[model samples]
Target: MFRDSLEAGARAVAAHFDHVLSDAADLPVLHAMRYATTGGKGLRGWLVLEGARLHDVAPERALWPACAIEAIHAYSLVHDDLPCMDDDDLRRGLPTVHRKWDEATAVLAGDALQALGFEMVADPRCHPDPLVRADLTLSLARAAGARGMVLGQALDMAAERADAPLDLQQITALQAGKTGALIAWSAEAGARLAHADLAPLTAYAERLGLAFQIADDILDVEGDAETVGKAVGKDAGRGKATFVSLLGLEGAKARATSLVTEACDALSPYGHRADALREAARFVISRRN
Candidate 1:
């Protein structure tokens, strides 16, 4: 139900952007942003709404900000799949933006989507509080910046060509910055938008993020492209540092279980405020795609 609600919200936002952005023929960039933002399974958006549910915030209000999170996620993937990055051709079973469109268009689309995410939160209809909107923008920016997701990406790439070697700690650190940062931001953004304190939620999201990454690493080793919707075994093939590569398959699975336990404990204070969160944590480790 939460995911369905978020999808409805995103459709509305996409329609809104399309209506406003259609006048510029020279700027196919805007259309690319709209297309990318509306795609995918909406895991990040669901996380935002789940966090907001903990605060008892209304779904309509949560939906718009959640849409913002989805936009940021979509933008990140577009850039991350470029030739300079992962060079991935497929994403969520569709050709990546760069492969479907031109490389320059893909780059511009990612840039525009980033701006659109912040703009959506700033819109008065989505958030009534200026301070809350500002906080969301700043928090999302930090999540996307060098200190967070980008730093993680840089670390991930550098580890591939590093002179020495990467231990489990280094691999985990990279995952924390890359995957964990955005997951943390999703929860933080939702909590702050609802005027709720995020101390416990932040802690829960941290563990949840780690668990999510561990599961991803495991899937890379065990999953096929039909199930994963992307290349598998490439991490090991390229000598890319990963939890599975360092910890072995069973060890990585064990670590994922431990993180899930830690995440569940962190949400104990919320009681039922975290029901959706708990479900999401379970889903994170168990999902095939």
Candidate 2:
């Protein structure tokens, strides 16, 4: 059920991108924008739609923010995979944006996607209430900006340059910002749209995000380029600190399992209605890529 919903959400967001980019100028940058947004788990967008559903918000109203988060996410990946960043050559089983196109085009495409993300959430179509649109726009800006993902990225780069590796606490804090911020925003989007309390979904996403990163760390140790679709073992190669490195293989797995349990527990307020979310948490730990 969770897999089906995830795929459906991915398709929905892809269609939204297609429609929005349909009339865009036939430029390489525009093509890169579309290519960059294609194919992923679409977990962030799914969180938006599922959280909205849980809160009784209409899917039509939820989709704008869903696509908005995805655009923001794709932009992040494009930047992160640049030669100046992780220097990756592949993503989602294809060339990274910078590899497929020139770095200049990749940069422009990422910039466009980021702007598009803000535009989508700020549009009145996302919510009837002007205040709701304002709130989403502001929150998304923070999540994607210096205080959040960028901060985390900076920390990661600094760690790579430092003589000593980051400790567990520092890495956790960095991952919370780099990876968890957007996930938290995605999970709380439904409540934001519905003007409901954000506590439960926030808690769920906090744990889920950490679990998801831990799973990534584990996969970095255990996965291959063919299955993971990106470079694996980079952390180990770089001698960077990660959950797996600090906690040991079994310990990291145990910690991720514990986090998934906590994430599922946070959804108790929604009872069986949140089963898919619980499954999502579990799937984060179990995913091959």
Candidate 3:
């Protein structure tokens, strides 16, 4: 059920992107923007739609923010895969944007995607209330900017340059920014749209985000490139500190399981209506990629 919903959300977001960018000038950067947004789990967008559904927001109203978050996510991946960043060669089983095209094109594509994300959130289609649109835009800016994801990425790069690897606490804080920030934003988006209390979803996302990173660390240790659709064991190869590195494989897995439990527990207020989100937490730990 979760997989079906996830795929549906992915298709919805992709179609929206296609419609929005169809009239964009025919250029390599525009093509790269389309290519970079293509293919992924679309987990962030799914979270937006599901959370909005839980809040009784109409699907049409939810779709705008859903695609907006996905665009932001895609832009992050494009920049993260650059030679100056993770320097990855593959993403979603294909060449990274920087590798498929030039670094300049990849940078411009990411920049455009980021701008498009903000534009989507601010558009009247996202929410009729201008205040709601402003809130979404402001929150997304914080999530994707220096105070959040960018902070995490900068810390990661700094850790690579430091003489010593980051300790467990440092890595936790880093991952919170690098990955958790956006996921938290995605999970909390519906509540924002509906003007509901944000505490419960915030709590849910905090635990889920950490668990997601821990699962990623575990996959880096135990998964294959073919299954994971990217390089495996990169953390070990680089001697980077990760959940698995600090806690050991079994301990890391245990932590993730416990976190998933906590994440589900956080959604108790929503009762069975949140069952799919609970399942999503479980799937995060079990997914091959």
Q: Estimate each model's TM-score.
A: 0.91, 0.99, 0.98
Model 2 scores what on Cα lDDT? 0.94
- Residue 174, candidate 2: Cα error in Å is 0.3
What's the lDDT for all of these models?
A: 0.80, 0.94, 0.94
lDDT of 3 by residue, 1-289 (tens): 8999899989988898898888899999999999988889999999999999999999888889998999999999999899988889999999999999989999999999999999999999899999999999999999999999999999999998999988999999999999999999999999999999999999999999999999999999999998898999899999988999899999999999999999999999999999999999999999999
Worst 10 residues of 1 by lDDT: 1-10
Clashing pairs in 1: none
Ranking by lDDT: 3, 2, 1
Superposition-based RMSD of candidate 2 using all C-alpha atoms, in angstroms:
0.7
**TM-score attained by model 2:** 0.99
Please give the distance, in angstroms, between residue 170's alpha carbon in candidate 2 and its true position after superposition.
0.3
User: What alpha-carbon RMSD in Å does predicted model 3 have with respect to the real structure?
Assistant: 0.8
Clashing pairs in 3: none
Error of 3 at 169 (Å): 1.3
The list of candidate 1 runs beyond 4 A from truth reads: 1-27
